[model samples]
Target: MDFRWWRRSFFGAFLSWVFFFLRFSCSDKACAAPEYTFVKEATSAPPVIFYDYIIIGGGTAGCPLAATLSHGGATVLVLERGGSPYTNPNITNIGNFASVLLDRSPTSPAQPFTSEDGVYNARARILGGGSAVNAGFYTRASTHYIKKVGWNQKMVKQAYEWVEQVVAFQPPLMEWESAFRDGLLEVGVLPNNGFTYDHLYGTKIGGTIFDKEGHRHTAADLLQYANPRKITVYLHAIVHKILFRHIPGTARPQAYGVIYKDAYGVRHLAYLKRNSKNEIILTAGAIGSPQLLMLSGIGPGYHLRTHGIQVVVNQPLVGQGMADNPMNVLLIPSPLPVEVSLVQVVGITKFNTFIEGASGLSFVYPLARRLAKRFRLFLNQSDYEPFKVPPEDMARAVDTVNAVVNRTLRAGIILEKITGPASTGHLELRNLNPDDTPFVTFNYFKEPEDLRKCIEGMRTVISVVNSKAFSKFRYKNMPIEALINLMLTLPINNRPRHATAAISLEQFCIDTVMSIWHYHGGCQVGRVVDKEYRVLGVDSLRVVDGSTFYRTPGTNPQATVMMLGRYVGKRILQERYLSRRSKHKN
Candidate 1:
């Protein structure tokens, strides 16, 4: 076998993936979107200003909340610590789904962080938040889930419809996605609910943010509903602390304002307009919300004192009960080439397991390098870098080029994450710098129940892999099958995954655990925030994102998160209206 021919094959397949995507795939319409006049750079913000509501983190929930509040004639200022997602090709193009996650640049939309559990995960660092960086699977929270959270079912339905109109669509199934759907049913996951957003127990097709053309619609698009004149959005505005003041008669620390730094390190202050109803909202995500709370002197008294932060509220549970859905995946290499697709088909099981799958996702370099190493390609470490040895069909600049240029795999993954992970962890401030990630340890599978649930989920996945509907895609006798089976048992970073046999499923669950990015809690519902999501011991401040979630909603949390923004925004407006009417009567 000629080694040069094998290397050429690598360049040929990889370059073809980039050339067509950048050249033909990203047309002008998809490449650029009209700039929103209301969306401004953080540097341009006034040194001190006031608004009816100050929203921190212009993410999935923040965007919709801002729009809802502004539409109701209240002035809203949304401070986002990340860049706009509109023009980012890695984000806008659904086909390049993995590119953003793989790009480890400082300014990448996905902020990559490794957990203490040694699992690789990323948090959203873009205007649209996780919706801009996620797999785009959109499914609503279960009816039982909504009721448990104490949200009005009718209002939840209306809010979901509002979000669906903007970002949700029934994605057309590709060859691989269709096969995944059939396999789920073949394995008796349940009745085929077929292309619906209802969170039923069955093999069903959920909505996606990706359209038929493979262009993604993010939470930023929902900003179109915002009243431009009333809502002001500032990108790269990092809120370091929530400002609190002592009201004359109130014992609680009143959140009156926030102190933030712009991208260029200029300090800016935004305050509430001094109305009793005016509030400061933290829509910053799970990790961000809790970290910010600690930095703002709102966490445990001892923890804040250790960091030299003056404790405003001694809330011990601010960062406690943090949970991430532990996901385990089985990679199946196909004999036939598969079409690229993101999350579309799902298998919601009866036994607290939710299974989702994606196929032909060419995850930039790491996956490609792993595949190349498996195939035993005669290539040095430098050869893999486009800078040192550019692929024959592309330029040397391809190394720095923000494009998905590697397509080595033609495989599908069957992944499962348990609904309510009994095991949880806590997040603490590593430092005061808002840019730095906080110290977090989500003790995955610490609870015996969680490990047991994972074993059951993986067993269902094995059934899907062995399903007759999935048989045609793979040649069982192929050498790739044996290679993947061997790869499954190998250890990563000294953590050994047990063999994929039935008896060793427990160890496999512990070793192979990774985050599906459905991590929630930190500022939990009852402990850190009230049922209305208002921060406990702090007046005029609330957390509206996943931080307040006790359990992840639906097959994915983005849909419910986005809906929560709308749901809460409407409720706030209604509360204000009723309050005004009561004052008039008095």
Candidate 2:
């Protein structure tokens, strides 16, 4: 029998099959890779663009939502006011954390502005939004928050996983972060939660978007999820207004399109498809969303009319309840160089305060020096009292002081933030012009309870620094009391020494408090949008960013913002499918 010939034939056939499999597998890999087609200028775009979903502000929320919707075969358009994050080193590099915020260019991802209270604040303008410029700390919303917000718990978990797969990273604990973690525990921050992506009580180390090599993975990275052929992204596309149409007898106004400008100052219009379940979503952060709504005639009726904007919905709460987490820093100047890190370890206290630590080379020295000069002016005369010196000036002073300490000494700065400030502020129209920044007032320390909590947070910082864990690195000359006294100088006016000192400390906080950039609550649920995230008085429009948060969660808001973005995307897809099925049945 010819058994050898049979075996040889089988082996030949097996080899041919293997080669065929290899060839097709390589081809499949090439096909699966995303090929993005971005529009860099508005002038290059078609005269008018149409999409099933148009998202304004290609930010943390907008990017993910666009990616999700586009992946589901929906034609999506993303309008971003700033340049692409891919080319911005300040946004892509973890070491440029301070530099991004320090940049004052008109196109910088972080757009710096002064609030009415004179506090210096910044809003993200880049495609990745706050995720591109923030400190990169990442953590999920509390289970309590998920329940309160009426989100599907199972779907929320999936959403977190979907985001984490691409952007979240486990930060390696360096020496400084390790010491900070120990100090937090020694001071009774207690029950170390360890490395996790979940929000937990006491001292815990959460996920970061910065990887091991010091590269940042922003929400812009999530754009990889997009089916590029179905999505169109326009950078430097500044949305000026959401065009609305009111039916003759209907009580609600319909948003049909958006008008925006390109970098070349050329205007363009993007409209939703007619006679379809198309929608326009606003993910323009806490400040920009409300400001845009007011511009579109959706804010307070009289306020819009004052600026010559025709009334549309007359939603008085559009920009009414703005709030930001107030933060203060205590610089611990170390003689030795400290390891560089971001918000790797956080101490969650019972008083609604969060203590975060960072140690690295100071990046904003020049800006800090300028702020220091302003602080000197603030201290010079009685006319320049705490409230008199505008919040922006005071914010500059506080930031300058922190920067100076960081630059002058090779040291670590222990920053304490009041996560849940009792006093809330508001945003108002500076003018009717869409290009002008909105007038913001944080009204920090307006509530006695907020002030007391801040004081306690400051004390906690001192205690952590004085703990045995930090004894090896603590500067001997910097006595806690002396440092506090130096930083909190005030005019003594015929009062007892104790009263004078107490008053001075309080004034120091009022003058130096700044927004940690955790701003939220403008187009909040029960106010501007409903639980489904739809604008109350507008059809085919939704708000899905930090602006829609009912209240600021206990930790950094970036993770939660991403989660909600994913959650809303899923809901939109579900609703679209249901609508299709209903139509088919009819």
Candidate 3:
């Protein structure tokens, strides 16, 4: 075999596998059937001519809202900007979550935006939206996040109960649990606090996990279960604008209907019939929800003018206070030669099966509870108060982190900087194109404190690696500098070498770092929507999902997002129905 032929064949095979993975594995699971035929059906139909409550964007927030609102006995129409993940091959495989970053997969429609910043990473162009392509790790909103939005503990606690009732929370079976446990115990980084699969929030460990059936207990699952007989879920439908009316005497504006486009590219507007009272809910998520509002003239007047969009309401809070989890995976080598396990692989299969049949372990709840009990070691227990400790304690913690980063140089642990100061980014409109990717400018680590946090995170990981238990495993930290050097040496796809040289403690806070693709916070509380998630100046519109969060929780957002969906859904239903009877005389 000549070198040329070998190289050509190897690269060809590699690319083939990449394309295959992108096609069949999207939903953090595997699939047995195509996930696009339904999208075809949705697109072929003419625009919806009638609906009492039209929920746009069947993503995280939209899914639950659609399902819950339909439970109100109202005629509901769910308009998804993308195709159904159930039918899209790109959404079943878990591994495709990483690969979809480079190319436009089946779910990611042509985005109308791009960014010099690396903040808002990728947008899913399918039915389940980001839920179909996310890491599947589940944690609810941090207390800081809830309070930041002016939601009291009682409200968030209630939201958690509502969310947990719908989502199956657990890890995989015994083997996966053992692996997670052994991995943590082996490193001796066992958390000192109690874990939570409960009502409380913060850095408490145990999070909601996917069961063997692949049902993630996400907004998608809840929506399906909570869906009402009157609600119609239409995949591949994108809402274009919200139809509004200026009340003749009142100071507030009223929403009457919505304009949306089906998969066939045909546009249609469903308006409120004369003398008919109707409410249009915009659960389109952080980006889509706000974008739709802006398109309908509901954002900052200046910003709207720049995009040639006429102003509906001069709500300046639109598109501000975006936050995301600064993530970086700390890679640890196996003590023994690595063995490929189908545990994660099984999750792939289960997710796909659910998309096709909506049954099996995917529909069970006990499976999640069992799984959560197994991976309790790596859980962190903290109140996650922003200023819990004194300033001196924080300063000392910063010093401790610096010391660990320095000491790791002597030990063999190669600290891979994943979520560092340089990972800070933001979400913005790339241009006037709504379908375009947003301008994601992550000026990561432009601030010094952020750099200290990354260094502290590195130190924390090292503390786990240096423990007595981990030493027994003899985990040799590979020479990470070598890996960094290799990446720098690469001709193409070479990233900026942010950690090229070690810095002194005096300069630690000033250093830069990279991102981990954990994008968050474009429509946070106290800004985008009020505590109840109602759009500030608009009636019957709300913002939910990751974007609505004030900040990314210490862990992943899937579980938290599910909670938001459920909480917001219940609140909307209550305010719309329960509060109404008291006001009526009939």
Candidate 4:
């Protein structure tokens, strides 16, 4: 195997998309950036610095939060475990979607981990977080979801618009996406509600972060709204632990500073300014937030003691209620060429399920061949449905132009995922190492209600595949059992799945479950944090990302997650400023 050939074959199409990102001047409004001077490499920070706020994780929520907190001249320090998204071609180019997700490198933007449930999943390791790596579909939370979360309705709308102006776009539907939309409606999925950003139940095209030119505009672009002079973002700065101490009159421990290590492995301390109501906020997504809390001795007392971590607060709920939307997909291996696209058209159903799709992702096969060998997993395509092998199969198909390379085995995927998975799990520390992924189990389909939704959603998918619009792609009746075995990678108890009808579709739903990358909770609002997102047992500490949500917002959570940052940032400004004025009068 020529490693050089693999490198060329892999990056050939990706390098072609470089022209779309060559000129990066934030001055152009279409580019969705500003003359931002705030970002600096983590190594550039001093040994110690006191600031108004120390935000951990420069991700989907962290970026906007930092930008909004910069208003009225307050300083913000954002510590990110990953590198900047600005210069990384993998983060900027849509063509590299599958490749980035398939990348198993220690520093890849999409960090891969296998859960305790034996399911493979990826989490963001870039400044833009999941937005830098996801399907880029943008939809607001349902009006009811917003109200249920107890957010100020007007402020939520205002925050969403602020983010939309910079990142979200009315994506142009390509041939594949256009047909996918028609297929949804033809199957009676909905009332054909055209293009809209609201979370309406029906077939419609939603906003995307990818522009007409196909370059991705991630949540990092939201930083253009930040006052550059007041914010400093440190990339590759992994916070080792949150520093806490008992205040003289406070009821519980107060977070005052954090100890982080730069890429060079040198430790640095960032703290809040004295007595002015400053705080340390954790916007480190669902996984990272709870992991950080446990590492900082703020989790369950017994668990912390096993690792020799002296308990600060015995918060038993630090890593509880972890949930991820279970995605089940069927592939259409097409002989004809299809345009490469992400999630543009979605079929929101009344059964608490969402049907979405992607096309022309043929680039992942050869790469999958390599990944299969690397992970020591058998690449038996005989049972596989098509291009993107299931996560359980240890391979992810990248969406490269198959026609460019004269490949005929192109493919598209029509995936259905349940919204409120209802079944949840917990997160636990594998070790004290912040660099290592913590143990998380989503316990897919553990609840009977989740399985019921899967059956209903699968039935809807069958209808969509049988629609007249999709007839041309259906080469033959591919066995559901093969898709289950190929996707779930479940070993037989001396029983070959394809040889016999040992598995039913209902059992397949339970066996073939995979993550849609919408995993959230663990540090949920009422359990771990207050309505204001402040940590319940600690002062000057807050958790402000998806981990706070009891359920994901709408069809996707990126838009709402980003909005939460701006919304919360605005609230902090209002409350903190009043406190500052009151203290001055004294």
Candidate 5:
């Protein structure tokens, strides 16, 4: 009766069975090749071509504009740097929102980068741009913002309807999102503007790009308006520079064409129709637009000269006044599993803060643990400064930090974004290389009021979590009180000496706050572009993306960005028609 031998034999059999199961369970499946009949590969495009309009960066604004222009009978060419979003399953599925951003492939639709101040950020490189990668929240710009920008209200409303028909939807509120909505209302963020797309104060459930089936309909879908025969969309076409020609007696340079490279590294030129009032428009995002402008020698004269680029225009404000909405996130672990959801509930507090919540098993288990560990380190270490860490260490730190804040798998996240902040940052060219990303410093919390508002937001989150609505779920082992105390330890500049501490609030913000990715300005109206959305100091060049925003609206900016694209497209068509009529009269 050898009991030990029997036990060892049982253990060996169990191990062998587990390995056999894994071997079969992990077998790879062959995937079918994706078809992209709507888009043309850059390598197949002619080396030199002409179009009635050459739109660079087929993104959020670019896609819609190309569709509108082509529908109006103008021959359009859209040059996009990233591949088609249709074939990327990570982008097409709403459940993979966070995972899509973690894609670090060289040609990933979402390009990840660290800002100059060491804040981890990402920009959309695909045809649909941010709309393809962002958390599916959708809300129109505030009426105040629309009037401030002086847009035609009627046209703007129509534009919103046009976009909503294609990409916007009303998400079904599940258990987690329902609880969040109740919590927001319990905290006095009242008058639940139920299921409205308008940007109003107080709690509201806005529109989403995710339909009932959890599928994402992106702005790229709006390309249906494009006349297929009239529009030529070249995927993986990276625009290097806007070709400008000097006209005698004109004070500014005229943008005539653009030089770009295909996916195969072959160069090509796209020119505007000769003897016609053709234009080259830049619909690149906030960072890409400013970076391209500087690369084309349209930024500060001194800065361009230092980079050995010949100055075309001395626009000092071209890369200045860059601003992004700063975000602070608090994770609440629960014993009960929270239902999966995106942003279906929002709290618009009186203190100028926008609070949104989401919870679910959205991320892979391994990634969730790594992110939780990183966040614990970030909050626990009082002296943690990402900039001081080495590149390798900083990357690990950022990954951990971003994983917790950005993903909503296994825990609930309360994200608070400052709707408006006076503090602003600037973008500068790192080098003359077109492949180099611009240096972004989002001088967050530089203003004392900014920190005060953020503190108020943190307190609001505590109130919402403690409310009766979240009573069912038990709070796990997070040191919520300790985190709140750390926020209170921040030094107030104007407060009494005893009330203030040696650790300045500004530094705490620099260590904790991250970009919510609602970037705007750099080429703003009244400074860089006119009210008509045309880039100043350059003829036939317009910026029709978020970069042209006078100020970042007080909500998720996708709706407004799309509205502006439609608005500007209508204006361009109207102007063209008027010109033709005047010529006939002459």
Candidate 6:
């Protein structure tokens, strides 16, 4: 009762034990609790709990579907394996979007894109999914692809409108797009009809420079429309399995609930509980969508059997028909040193100070897209040969680039072209477990056309850069010494150049150049899901992300994915999952 030493020592020791107990104490049974009973709360009896719909993967398509369906007053639970988007700073910053590609760590382990064989491709893994962490580039699909995907004008146009509203897309401001235009013009590649390239179906192609706020807009901004009570977006909930139950007598089965793990590593089951009544939609993008289905026994028989996973349905197309737009950037030494960081092409530079916040290179999409469209239309009308590029298309592309260069003083260029052949890829289950990353094989250049076009495009880039106009920019003498060193290190270009004492463009491409991080394709048409995006053999499950593309678009896939999400959401809403649930009330 008397000592100051006793008070300090005994009380401090007691508090330490309390802190340790609170931090680490937990029942082994609770930590390893199975799917059910984890969330059990005792009422007068076992409380009846049910959800009208359960959606796994709160990614690009999943978020929208969850929002749209939840608005109907039915209980909707969105299970995302990643953490809450609120904590991620990089998720909202447009500049950091591209940097996410460079991060291949475990917290955001790089998802398999290209095969372990040749190409390099990177993907994002967070709550907002890829949208939470992707470059803010947006482009709608070409008219040909839209029609091929089995969408009529009415449906496609409607989807476009939905995308525009959500992303707040607009033509680049004149000042913003002007630098890009100037750059093309300086090189004499400007198109005659102006730069905004709108297609036959009104879909446009061009880069997004400045956003509507006069600030840059990202997909995180668009997907965040699910706010307050409308949508319950849960993060750090990785879906382990999609619970399915077959019709009592029939062979067909329907998905009803999802079993997932929470942040605390506690597993919980949001069971449908109703027999053949609830709907489960798999909007988990191309890669994840197919992988999840296979985990649940819904992919190619041989592959599933080989992986030791029982095949619920031998849907051969489950992970086939993958396609991605092969991206290549042509680089040239600029006469003037760019003070801005060029490590990766991004951000609002001082050049943006000219008009409407900042307008030069950022706002040129409208002008550029218009020109690309006219050229595309002209090519389609003529007898187009892949290997033999028509003189007309070449001249047109050259003119477009020249016009843009001259307009923007920012020289030393890299023409990014999506002209390569669209090769298919696949994602097979590497393991029977859902949590494991699957083996993805892009098989990028499977077709001869893909190889030829890529080679041709590289040659075309060389021909233009080595021309008379660029040679005068003090660049003739400065022949990318760094690139030469790279070529020497790698045997990608072993053959002799066209001339001696000078490196040719073809050599640079074959050696130093590599694929842009734009890998796409895999869960494409005829392979992954049907025309409506419904998995061919499964009921109520679908894929609606870049993975759903059969042939990669000639440009970026953001706008196309947005359009698909809207299209699927409308179809689901029109069909009304609520009405189906009402029927099960009895």
- Whole-model lDDT per candidate: 0.78, 0.73, 0.47, 0.77, 0.72, 0.48
Query: Considering summed lDDT, which 10 consecutive residues are worst modelled in model 4?
Result: 15-24
Residue 345 accuracy (lDDT) in model 4: 86
Q: Write the per-residue lDDT of candidate 3 for residues 1-586, one digit (tens) a residue.
A: 2343332222222222221211111243322332221223455555546767666777766676666667776677777777555543334443332334434444453222223542224465655666665545445554655675565578667766665665434443233223433433444333322345532321123433343443333356555455445766666666767888877777778777877676666787776544333566666655666667778888779888888887878977676655433332233333332222211211001011000000001101332222222212111112222213444544443343233233221111122222212344445555654565555555555666555565555444444445444443223333222222222221111123233222222232223222323456556567767777667776656666666655454344556666566567676677667556866955
- Give the per-residue lDDT of model 6 (tens digit) for 85-165: 444444433333333443445566234343443444445566546655544454556677777667876886777666565
TM-score of each: 0.87, 0.85, 0.70, 0.87, 0.84, 0.68
lDDT (tens digit, per residue) of candidate 2 on 144-241:
88898899999999999999887787777777778888999999998899998777778998777766556677788788888878888888888999
The segments of candidate 2 whose C-alpha lies over 4 angstroms from its true place after superposition are 1-35, 363-408, 485-505
TM-score of candidate 4 relative to the true fold: 0.87
Per-residue alpha-carbon lDDT of candidate 1 for residues 1-586, written as tens digits (9 for 90 to 100): 3454333333233222321121123323232454699999999999999999999999999999999999776899999999998778877875565467556678778887777777667789999999988777789998999888889999999999999887777766778778888998988888999989999999898877775567777889888888889999999999999999998888988999999999899999999996899999999999899999899999999999999999999999999999999887776666677776666788998888888777663544654654545433312223233222324323212221212224555666777889888889989888999878888888899899888889899888887777788887654543223323433432322245443332367766777676788999999988999899899998999999999988888879999999999999999999888888899999
Give the distance in Å from residue 131's predicted Cα in candidate 6 to where it truly belongs.
2.6
Cα lDDT of model 4 by residue, 342-379, tens digit? 67789999989899877765544566455334323324
Point to the candidate with the largest TM-score. 1
Off by over 4 Å in 3: 1-41, 93-103, 109-115, 118-120, 142-162, 172-195, 198-209, 213-218, 272-277, 333-335, 339-426, 471-477, 480-495, 498-517
Question: Backbone clashes per model, in order?
Answer: 0, 6, 47, 1, 0, 58
- Error (Å) of candidate 6 at residue 288 is 1.1
By TM-score: ranked, best first: 1, 4, 2, 5, 3, 6
What residue runs in model 6 are displaced by over 4 Å at the alpha carbon? 1-49, 84-86, 95-99, 109-114, 169-220, 223-230, 273-277, 339-415, 433-436, 463-474, 479-517, 577-586
What is the TM-score (0 to 1) of candidate 2? 0.85
Model 5 segments more than 4 A misplaced: 1-38, 361-409, 476-479, 482-510
Candidate 6 local Cα displacement, residue 228, angstroms: 4.7
State how far residue 32 of model 6 sits from its true place (Å).
40
